[model samples]
Target: MTTARPAPPRPTTAALKVPYRRPALLERIGEHPAGIVAACWVLLLAILCLLAPVIAPYGYNDQDLGNVLAGPSAAHWLGTDPLGRDILSRLLYGGTDAFVGIVQVTLVAVLVGLPTGIAAGYLKGAFDAVSSRLADIILALPSLIILLLLFAIDPSARTAAMITLGLLFSPSLFRIARAMSLQASQELYVRFAEVSRVRKGLIMLRHILPTALPPVVVNLSLMAAFALIIQSGLAFLNFGVLPPQASWGGMLQDAQMVISEAAWMMVPPAVAIGSLVVCFITIGDAARDIVAAATTPRRRSRRGESLEVSVGSVDAEESIVVAPSPTALLRVRGLGLSRAASGTEPAAPLVTDLGFELQPGESIGIVGESGCGKSVTTLALLGLLPANITVDRGEVVFDGEDLTTASKSRMQQLRGRRIGYVSQDPMVGLDPCYRVSNQMIETIRRHSDLSKSAASERAIELLRSVQLHEPERVMSRYPHELSGGMAQRVCIALALAGDPDVLIADEPTTSLDVTVQHGILQLLEQIKRDKGLSLILITHDLNIVPALCDKLLVLYAGDVVEHGPTLDVVTRPRHPYTRRLLDCGLHGVERGEPFPLIEGTVPHPGTWPDGCRFRARCGLATAACAEPGARAVRRDGAVIARCITVREGASEAAALVGAVRTIARPVSVIGDDPNAEEADRG
Candidate 1:
C-alpha cells in the first residue's frame, strides 16, 4: 500500500522559543565576578539613598548649636558639619541627592542620545546629516559654561542645570550608539531577518538594539560618572545646591571651606565620589567585555513558549506516471528585479529576464564573475533581497504556486520548508549569539512535532548526514568555536532541518581550503542522490560546476549570456565571457603572464551598455554585436549565448576549460581523490 504524505513544516525563522534561554544582558553582566561586585556596590549606594532618613541620626538641615563642629561621639556620629548639622545625616542625604542628580543626568542623556543615534543610523539622509552636525556642535560647546549660564538664568534651577549638563554629555553616548547601530545594521543576521519577512520593528529590537546596547551602557555609565564629577567640581566652586539641602557636591564644598581646621571633613565626600566613580568605571569595563565576547551564549535561563510544533499527516495522492521534461520543480520565466529609485538615484536592474528550470534530482549551476547577479537571483528566489531591491517583474513558479505574488507569510513558510538556502560564507549563516544545538534544535522543533530532546536527536542525524561526526559535541559549541569546514557542515545541517525539497548553495566553497572544498562538493553530490532533491548552485568558478551540476546558466550584467547542459556550455562555450573565465583561470590577475580570469572588472550597474554589457571586454566584439538584441541569442529553443559566435557544442571552446580537467586540477577541488576523507554513511 502507498504511504501517506508528511504534514506541512513550521516556519523556519518564525517563533523559535528556547526551552531555556539566558536573560541576554543580565546573564552576561551578572555571571562575571567583577560585574557582580560592581553591581553590588551600585546597589549598596542605592540602598543607602533609599534608607537615608531611617538610618541617619538627624535631619540634613537640623542644627544643634551646642554640638557645633563636634567630633564623632554617641550624640553626634561622624561629628557635626559647619552648620552644626549631623554630618552622618547630611552625608546620607547627600548620597540621595547625588543619586537623584545622577539619575536625572543619565535619563536625559539617554533620552537625547538613543533616539537620535538609532535614527541617524537607520535613517540616513538629511536627518542623519543634521543630527550628526548638531551633536558635533553640542560636543564642542563649553559644558561648564552652559551649566553656569543656566544657573545664571535661575539661581535655584537645579533641574535646568542638570538637564543642560546631561544634554552636553549626550554626544558621547550618541557616538557609541551610532557606531554600534551602523555596524549591527550591516550584520548578516539582520539582513537575514529582513529577507525572512521579520518585521522591521522586531529587527531593530531583536538584532540591532541587542548589539548597540552593551556599548551604549558602557558609555552611559562613564558619562554618568563624569556628570557627577563635574557637578562636584561646580559645587566645590560655590555654584550648586545653595546649602541646607544636602548634596554630595554641596558637602564637598562645605568640607573645602573648613579643610584647614577640620581636614577629616573633606575625606568623607571625597571618598564617596572616588569610590562611586570607580564602581561606574568597573561596571563599564565589564559591559565592554560582554560586547567583546558576543559569541558566548547567555547562560541565564529564561522560561519561554515551547517551540515544539505538532503537525498532522494526511493521505498521499495516488501514484501517477511521471513525465520527463515537463516536471519542473521550479520555473522562472522572464524574471526581472531591480533596486528602487531613491532621490536622485535611478532604479538599477540587478537581475533581468532571468529564466531557469530545475527538475527533481537535478543540479543547475549559475556561474559568472563577481557582480554578475548570480547571488542576487538566488536572493530573489527566496524573497530575501535587501530593502533597496524589489521584484519589479517576474514569475517564480515553485511546485505550481506563483511565488512572486505570494504573501510575506506564505513566502516565509516556503523558506526552509520547501526551499532551503546556503549563503556564500558559512560563518555568516548562523547567529553568533547562539550555540549550534540551540539554533539547530530550535529550527528542527519549530518545523516538526518534536520535543526538544527529539529535535536534538534529529539535529544529530542531520549533522551525520552532512558528514560532521561527533554531532553531540559540535552542537554544544558556538559559531566562533567551530572551524570553517565544521561551520559549513552545521550550516548544511541547518538547511536540512525542515527537510526542504530544494537546496540553493550560493558559492559554498568560496573561501574553504582545497581538501574541504572537494569533500563539501562530494557531500552535496551524495545528498542530491540520497534525498532526490533539486539543486541551484551559484558560483563564479567555471571549473567547479561539473562536479555536482548537470545544467549551467552563465550570467552577465544580470542577463543570461549562455545556458545549457554543463558539458555543452563548458565544452563549447558560446559566449566570450564564459570562454574568458576558462582562459584567465580562477585567481584573476594573480596567475601572472597571461593573467588569471578577465582583465577588466564587471561594469557597475546603470553603466552597462544598451545592447551587450560584455561588448567593451569581448575581443570578437563587432558592430553587429552591439545591436539592441545582441545580449541574448536563441538556439534550438534555449538561450545559447549573447555573442556573434553561436556555435553549439564546438570543440574550440571546450579545449579552453576541458584541458584543465585531464590534468591534476580535479584532485583538489572537483576531482575525487581516493586518499581524501569520505562520508561514512554515504
Candidate 2:
C-alpha cells in the first residue's frame, strides 16, 4: 500500500512572508528639519575648511604694509591690522589655527581620558579611588596661574597655552566619562556580555564606547570652543603668539591701544571670535538637545486618528511563504549564568540550569519577578551581558553555528541581520535627532547591500507593514514628533527591516498606554502569524502568556519553578510557587477585592535557601524540606514539582488548606474570638 508521506507537514500560517527591504539615508534625514539644518551647517563648515586656500585672496599670515589700519574697502576688506596685515587674511588663518587646536585637544582628551575614566569607573575600588583623587587634585590647582607660570618659564607662549588648556580640560573629561561608564557598566546588556564570554576590549569599544561617545562628542565641542577662547585670551594678554604673528586675541589687544584711531580693528577681530564661539555653542547645544530628545519618553500624538488596518491585505497569498522546520532552527541547552564574586565559598548561580528550544515559527514567553534573571537570560542569548557575570555552561546552536563559541565578528553579523532585538525602552533604543525613517534606514544599511533608493522604498514598505499611518509623513518626521506608540511601531519596523529569524522582545509594551499596549500586542501577534518568526518574549505580565506564547518558563528568584505548555501552566500549576503566583494575580482574586500579594521578597542570590530555593516562603515546607538540597519530583507527563513531599498527600493537602485559611482570615480578628468579645460586653 502506497501511503502519502504525511502531507509534507503543512507550512505554518503564522510566519511572515514578505520580501526583505531597507530605507535610504536621505529619505530619513528629510523627515527632520532640525537635523537637516544641523547637517547643512556642518557641511558648510567642512567645505569652508577644505577649500580655505582657494577661497582666501591672500595668505593667512601675509601682511600688506600699504594698507595698515585701513577700514572696509575693495582692496583691504574688513581693514588691515597694525602690522598692515589683511584683517580678513588673519581671520582665515586664525580660524585654521583655532580649528587645529579644537581638533587636537578634543582628540587628545577622548583618546587619553575616555578609556582611563571608563576603566576607573567600571572597575572601581583601587582604580576608581586613585582616579577620583587625582581628578580632585587637578581641579584644586589654579589653571590660569599655572598657565601664566608656564608661559613665564617657557619661551614659546603658544606651547604653554595649549599644554595648559589640555591639562585644565582633562579633569572634566574624566568626570563625564566616569559617570557615563558607571551607568552603562550596570546595565543588563553589559551583564549579558560578561556572561557570553565577550572580550573586555570588545565590550569597552563596541558596547560601552558607542553609548559613551555621543555625550563625549558634545562635551568635546564645548571644550574646543573654550580652548579657542583661552588661547585668544592669552594672546590678548601678550603672553601668546608673540611678535609679528597675529591672532584674533592679539589683534584685539593692539586695537585697544589704538581704539580711538582704529576702532575697526577691535570690532572685526572681536566679531570673528564671537561668531566662531557662537557657532560651536550652537552646534553643541543642538547635539545635546538631540541626544536628550532621543532619550526622552515620547508623548502620544493627539492629532492623529487611530488607524487599524487588517494584516492580510498588504501581501498577496502567492507572495506569503512558509517558515522552515522547527528542529532545523535554533536550540539552546543547559544554558546557565550568574553574577557573584568568586571566592573560597562556591558562588550561587543567578540563572541555574535554564534550557529551552525555539521552533522556526514558535513564540515562547519567559515570565518572572524582577531580578529573576529573565532579562539576563535573553542578554546571554544575544551575547550582551554585563562584566561582573559569568556564564558557567551553555550551548546555543543556531543554523548549524554554535553561537556560544562564535567569534565577535560572527556574532555582530548575526545580531542585526540574522537576529533582531526590540529593546524594552524604545526611548533609549532610538537616536532622537534622527527622523524615524532615518533610523530605520540606518539599520537596513548596516545589514543589507541594497542601494539608497531600494532601501528607502523598503523602509517605507516596512513602515506600512507595521501598520504605521501616513508612512511617508512619519518617515520624514523626527523621533520627537512621534508619540510613544508611534515610536514603538517604528522600532518594530526597524526590527523587521533585516527580516530576522529570531526576535527577542524585552518588555516591549511596558512604557505604552493600555490602548497602545493592546495595539502593539495585536500587531506583534499579527506579525508572528504572518512571518512564522521565532520569538523569546521577556515579560512580567502573566496575562500576556496565554494569548501570545505557546510554552512558558516561570522564573522566581533566578530559578525556574515551573515549565510546560502555556495553557497547562496557567490552568494547573504543579509547583507551589507557580500556584501562589497565579492565586495572587488579578484574575484569581474576587472582583473589587484587593488582589492577593506574594508574602516575602525574593531572596538575593547569595542568601538563597540551602534546601529548596522557595522553601522559606513555601506553605508546604516541612522538616524534610528544611533538609539540604531539594530534588525535582515528576508528576503527570512533563510537569516537575520541586517539593519533597508530593507523596505525603494528606499532610501536604492539610498544609495547603491551612495556608489558604491563614490568607483568607482577616488580621483584625486573628487569635480573637467574636464570642469572647460579646461575653466581655455582657
Candidate 3:
C-alpha cells in the first residue's frame, strides 16, 4: 500500500503574518511627490493632444472678419488673431507638429543606431575605429548649419528634414551603445559562450543588449524633449513643418504681425508651448532618476509573506519558548536561495533544501565543484547576495535570533561585527587605489567606536598576528604592490579586524600555489583555535576536508549526497557521488598512474532528472532510483546518505540489467577494476 506524503514545512516568516492593506493613492503621491506631479502633467497634455478635435470649440483655420481683433469674449475666447482665427482652437491643434515630428525622428534614430552600435561594440577592431571617426566628424559639424543646408536643397520637405535629423542623432546613440557593449563583453558568461562557439548575433542579442539598453533608453527620453523644442523653434522660423498646419512656430509668426494691436493673441499659444515643453523635460528627468535607482545596489525586500520574527524577543514578557540545540551555535534550517524568474524562464533554484549547523570552534567544509552554488550559499548566509538573488524560504538562527526575517539595519549590525567573510580572490576584494590601512581602519571605525589612531593600531596588530612581515610597511602598501600570498594574508587580517565570532572563508586558497595554499589553511586553523571561532570553510578540494574540517557536507549538483564525520566519510563513503569523488582523488594514485574520472558532467540547472539529482552520473542507477522524492538512509547521529539504491541491495544479474537501462553515457565496465560495484544496498 502507498503511504501518504508529508506536507512541506511552512516558511518561518510566512507562517504567522496578517494581511496588510495596499497603500492609498494619496500616500503613494506623497512618497514620490516630484515624480507624480511630473507624470500627471505629461498625462494631462497627452490627453489634451489625443482629444484635441473633440475638445476644440471651432476649426483651427476658421476665419470670421466680423470678430477681427476681438478681445476675450463669450463668442471667441482669448481673442482672435490678425487672420481672425480662434487662438484657443489653434493652441489645441498645435501639439501635433511637436509630438509627431519628435516621435518620427527618435524612431528613425533608434532603428539606425541600436543594431549598428551593438555590432561595433561587440565585434570591435577596424569597423569600430572607422565608425568612431565618422561619428566624430558628424558631431563636430554645427547642427543648425547642417539643417539649413538640407532645407536649402529641398525647402518645405518635412520628411527629408526628419530623416537628416535622425542621422545626426545616430552618432551619439552609437557611442553609448558601443561603450556599454565593451564593458558587457568582458563578463565571464559572455566569454564562455564565445568559447563554446555560440552565434555572434545571438550573443549580441541575449548577453550584451540587455545591459546596454537601459542607458540608451534614458537617452531616448531626453532626446525626445530636446527634439520638441527644436521642432517648435524651426516652425517659428517658417523652416519647420509648414504654415496652415497649426504648428507652434507658425502661430508665433502670425502673432508677431498683430503684437501691438492684439498682444493677447500670442499669450494662449506661448503658454501652451512653454507648459507642454516643461512637462516633457520633467518626464525625461524622472525617467533618468528611475534608471539610476534600478541600477544601484540596495537591500532586497522579502518577496513573499514572512514566516516568523526572531526567537529572542525584544520585550521581557516574550521570552524564548523553544530552546536551540546544545551543539548549535548557528543553525540554518530549510535554507533555499533563488533568483526571481525573468522573461520566459521560471524561477530557478540556485540552492535548495540546504540545512546545516555549526558549533563554536567547529569547522564544516562545504565541498562542491564550481557553479554548484557553493559561494551563493555563503553569500546568502551573510545577506550579501546580489539584488536578483534572495533567501526564498529559510530560517537562520544565530545565537537564538532569527536572521531570515531580520531588518536591513539588524543585518548590517551583524555582518561585520558578529560575522566575517574572506572571499576567493584577494585582489578583487581589496581596493587598488587606497593603501591597505585606509580600508582596514575605515572598516574598523564603521563597525566599532574606535578613534582613527586606535583603529590603525588594531589593524597593525591583526596584520602582525596573521604573520605579515613589518605590519606598518604592509599597511602603507597598496593592493597591487603586494604578491598573491601577501594580498591573501592581508585579506585574512582584514576579516579578523572586527574581532568577529564566526569567520567564513570561501575558497580562500583556490588562487594560490600548493605551498601558499598550505600556509593559508594552516593560518586559518591556527586562528580558529586561538579565537575559538566558528569557521565555515567552502572548498571543492576534498583532500583539505580531512585535515581542516571536523564535519563533511558533500554537495553534488546543488544536492547534499552525503554528510557525516570528515574522517569516516573520507575513508568509507556510502553515496555513489561520495565514492566516485574518492576514486577520482589523487591521494592513493602514484606518480605514473592516471586518476579516475566520473562518467558524465553534473547536469545544468533545471535539467536534472526527477527524484535523484545524481542519477544521471551514478553507476548504481535503477528503476527504483527514478521514483519521485529523494530517499535517505540514516547512518549515525545527523549522518545520512541520500541514495535509494543504497537501501535496497541488488543481485549481480539485476545490477547488470539496471546498468544497461540507466546508462547516461555508454561505456564498458571492466570486471578487473575492484572498485566497480553494482547499483545496490546500504
Candidate 2 wrong stretches, greater than 4 Å: 1-328, 340-348, 588-592, 633-635, 645-682
1-682 per-residue lDDT for model 3 (tens digits): 1232332222231112322223334543344456668778767766776677999888888887888889988878787877788877777788765677778889988987877788889999998888888888878888778888877877687777777888888888888988989998998989999999999999999888877776787778777776777777788888866767787778888888879987877787788767666766665555554544444343333455332211111121111122357778898766767766532223456765566788888889898777678888888888778877888766889888888888889999998788998999998879999999999899889888999999999998899999898999999999999988889999988888788889999999899986688678878888998999989999987766666788888887666677777765665566878767656655445568877787867655434455567777877788766543343333433456666534323354754543333221111121123332332111
lDDT of 2: 0.69
For each candidate, the alpha-carbon lDDT, in order, equals 0.75, 0.69, 0.72
Candidate that beats the other on TM-score, 2 or 3, i.e. the better one: 3
- Which order, best to worst by TM-score? 3, 1, 2
For model 2, what is the error of residue 430's alpha carbon versus the real structure, in angstroms, after optimal superposition? 0.8
Better of 2 and 3 by lDDT: 3
Q: Considering TM-score, which of the candidate structures 1 and 3 is the better prediction for this target?
A: 3
Please name the candidate that would achieve the greatest TM-score relative to the true structure: 3
Q: In angstroms, how far off is 18's CA in candidate 3?
A: 34
As a whole number from 0 to 100, the lDDT of residue 121 in candidate 1 is 79
Q: Between the candidate structures 1 and 2, which one is better when assessed by TM-score?
A: 1
